[model samples]
Target: MENGNGLKIMEKNGLSLNLKLQNGTKVDNGTHWCFRGNKELDTPPEITIRGVLGMLKDSLDPSDPRPTIPLGHGDPSYFPCFRTAEVAEKSIADALHSANFNCYAPTAGLPSARRAVAEHLSADLPYKLIADDVFITVGCTQAIEVALCALARPGANILLPRPGFPIYEARAVYSHLEIRFFDLLPEKGWDVDLNAIEALADENTVAMVIINPGNPCGNVFTYEHLEKVAETARKLGILVISDEVYDHITFGSKPFVPMGVFASIVPVLTLGSISKRWIVPGWRIGWLATNDPNGILKKTRVVDCIKGYLNISVDPTTFNQGALPHILEKTKEDFFQNIINTLEHTSEICYQKLKEIDCITCPHKAEGSMFVMVKLNLGLLEDIKDDMDFCFKLAKEESVIVLPGIVVGLKNWLRISFAIDPCSLEDALGRIKVFCQRHSKQK
Candidate 1:
């Protein structure tokens, strides 16, 4: 190809290579070689939690002496206060030292780990779960991706929650699965907008996703609410993709109810992980269970599809799998309760401190998960244009990172993680309050 300067540019795989002449000598015109990025991956960077967190971290001021307070994403393992149980660490060590799990694990995962997860989750269910019902995943992240792939079809769509996890949309869009959002009523403890679901679904809709003890909202769904959800899915002839990654970490009045409880009413694909409850996200042990008591998933070939996908995918470590039974069976209740108590402390701190800021409005208290979604009153701030602007400026000036709510399908809002130390949580919110005051219209 010829450029404006009349030098020939070589091409490879539809991208411009370095300039060269007929004699094969590289031209010195200083035109750098470049390539295009995948169009499918563009949506993920703008919406994913990790992408936003990385952007916020880059906006930090190098000259600032204070430490960066990360309130953006919900990985609390960074804090010393939220370490995993000793038994969990010991289990992995013992498995590794045994040298029995050095080889690659089965693509679907080791049978023992699968059975352990099945039995562990079965405790909360109305019926028993066999090992075949569960497919171990690298993490809940992979579980969601594989689940979406299994459901994706030509001219198909899925219903999602507003202010929901962006990974659902990212993976869906990547797989060419259409997305239809139904709001979660913040006014009613972020309950599913059943009317909206009824209106949005059609023959092409396959399933609806529900994150109980939610991610950004952190409001646990009541048994009655989940029952209504099951009824709605049944009426629509669709399944429920229940994301219970934050299971049993609840500190709210309403108890944590497994969507598997309603597997008899409708097919529920329940996704869970050791990430949140055990505070070991880096451990990367998770499961995707077909909680259909009637065998609808197997009948529909959905379980087969999931297995096919996992066949080509990477498995969690063999040693981790070998240790999972001990980890699940031996970990004491105190370790779990300690996490809940710490989260409760930080949640209260987030609620009270967010109240002190005029520009931020938190609709519901965080009762389960590490995050709480708050609406941004952009009108109250003199210079802040939107949630992204507020977060970027906050990161640059205060060294505090927060997530823009638009990434999670809500505009003019922010999602904050209260999963850090209590002191750090208070300090970060205090900085946010000062930032708001400094940028206030009255100021």
Candidate 2:
């Protein structure tokens, strides 16, 4: 390396190592060895959604009359059928009237709100939980972030679902935690591949995240499957973080099973929100419920670790916290039933339509949640290259915006949200069919 004086700098005798500009100009080695920033940053994240939607933002014309059909986000509040219940709105308004909620809430959460979540969730568990076991978070997203941050340690690892939510991966990466992915076998209607999880875990693994009524795949776990998950986590000597954010939206053959039911055998951290069930995602109230009936989490001080972390975290708005019980109880039965019916009908339309698209295949009809994960057969499409390319082309050619499955760590597959209004869902599917047919290999 040459210094500014055009003197050749010796490797060993120089004050520091090779330090020079790209033009071989002299630079202080201090800039080169500036310590304490993440060095592993350039490494691609194990999963993310960035590249999936990159091209969509650039290609769309402002004057185009066709609206963007969003099947990428899970929220359906924009759809009439899935809007928040009127009673929920009134309860939140009522809570706002109380000056008592104006102060900063306790770090763990507001006491009354925690108690309400505990009582509501405990209705399904064999063992009851107290307010101390419930921690209010900004939303389920933060609940997962806190759990991952709390459990992360040097050389520590965590297991995640392959075709799962990417927020887990994002938080894990930010916390510098190593991640090992386990597959949910689509062949078996999206059951967890136990052997794969067993292969991934060792002493370093601190926890495994399981999504019930899964995110991208949308199939609910059976009690038997959840029992096996609990047993596996127990054997691996790690905790289970069950994300039940989509708890009761099932319309398939199997019902949604709460993993907390098996908490007696293994410590479980349950993450949930009022987002899906109550159709109030923007309200952003969620809870992190610790279910360790055997007290393993308490014994290990994991519970305390979570509390310490929460002390530095933000709580859900105090007003939203106060609205918990009312939202849980007062949301009418008819409102709940109508949302489920809308989801089911929309999912059926997607399923039937995708089957007819020559280039695409749905492995399983979505039974819960708002999305379905489908495999795109590249061999059947003429111009598209892969999932990302296919989605880019689909968005450009058809004005439809479905998520590329590669965002969820699965390639050549896509997760489509059918949670929009029925007519919009119909339009999106029609566009998808037209796009596929126009690009078909047969064409």
Candidate 3:
């Protein structure tokens, strides 16, 4: 027998049962339950750099003897050459031993930790910052999320750089903020195309993000250029979110300039962390500071939004927060200098090695951050299809890992991390050269 709608039915003692075969067709068993039904959870293509790299890693040969050289991301703590300072490690150990900070931290952060971050960041700016202006986050990643959430409103838009960090795009999309892209002119040392930025902004544009000592490009902005960006934001009546997570890691002639220096001209949200500088990304301690000496952010209630969000969000690890004061106050300058020196040496080696490869061209030598964006000469390689194909082939054949530029919104280019040990970096580049030579069309 069959019930309504041709469902097979059975009845006993006035109870009816409807059964359907578990075929590949959609079956409503009093609920629409299917593993593939929810499209909302599906990840969009090219949305995350990690996801793309993970796919390439899965395709790597199991029989390969050489250890995988990760030139993909900016993590180098695994290498002995990039270890964190002893003082930072000692501070965390001391905090743990004291047993004073195991409890939950305050919503914004621990008062002492916030104050320490304020003081540390204030040292670089003309104006001073109080603890109230600093909010501790899990890492710069959360700092970015909180900032975007605070700024996003219905029918509002934001400006981002092209060939930029994918996190900004991912967060903006998740927050329902309309994103408009402006170009970073590669021919001009990857400077922000100010004219495009001006054209992209409308009255509905809420904010613009600038990643100084840029993430994928490794180009640092000069003070004059930052001044123009500030001016542009002020004229647009929009806020500036300065991602300075890689602060002061410069190797080239241009010194690292914090976008907060121009906060007097426009309201700026400065995001920073000890991750890159201290070489301890796993610590999960970072801050978002409002650099508005004029109280513009407070006046607009953007500060209130951030606090409200933080009130419901998880704070960074308490013991790590307890260690911040010591980390900021006692870490020797020589420790920082050593990191810069090592990065400078590794970057030069990578650049010189890359220059010798006939199929790749580096537009500019890496100046600040741990990455360099190089244009891949796909035409010179007969078998490789695109950046994705190139990366897969390189990983499978050479046991090397590098980020495809398509993940960063630039096709036919590559973002290489030179932050590994100098010897490993040299070896990886050499392997890349060999791979390119092996696939060269000339042969």
Query: Each model's C-alpha lDDT?
Result: 0.92, 0.85, 0.91
Report the Cα lDDT for candidate 2.
0.85
TM-score for all models, in order of appearance: 0.92, 0.90, 0.93
Over 371-402, each residue of candidate 2 has an lDDT whose tens digit, in order, gives: 89999889988878888888877777777888
**lDDT agreement of model 3 with the native:** 0.91
> What is the descending lDDT order?
1, 3, 2
Q: Report lDDT (Cα) of residue 381, candidate 1.
A: 88
Worst 10 residues of 3 by lDDT: 21-30
Worst 10 residues of 2 by lDDT: 30-39
**Cα distance off (Å), candidate 2, residue 213:** 0.6
lDDT of 3 by residue, 1-443 (tens): 86556566567679665455344334453553354533433576555888988877887888999889999998889899899999999999999999999999998999999999999998988888999999999999999999999998999999999889998988888888999999999999999999998999999999999998899999999999999999999999998999999999998999988998999999999999999999999898999999998999998999999999899898899999999999999999999999999999999998899989999999899899899999998889988999989999999999999999989989999999999998888889999999999999975
Better of 1 and 2 by lDDT: 1
Question: For model 3, what is the error of residue 319's alpha carbon versus the real structure, in angstroms, after optimal superposition?
Answer: 0.5
* TM-score result, candidate 2: 0.90
| Winning candidate number (lDDT) | 1
Per-residue lDDT for 1-443 in model 1, tens only?
A: 78776668777788676566544445444654344457787565656788888988988999999999999888999999999999999999999999999999888889999999999999998899999999999999999999999999999999999989988988999889999999999999999999999999999999999999898899999999999999999999999999999999899798999999998899999999999899999999999999998989989999999999999999999999999999999999999999999999899989998999988898899888899999998888899999999999999999999999998889999999999999999999999999999999984
Per-residue lDDT of 40 in model 3: 32
Pairs that collide in candidate 1 are: none
Cα error of candidate 1 at position 26, Å? 18
Over 4 Å off in model 3, which ranges? 1-30, 33-41, 44-46
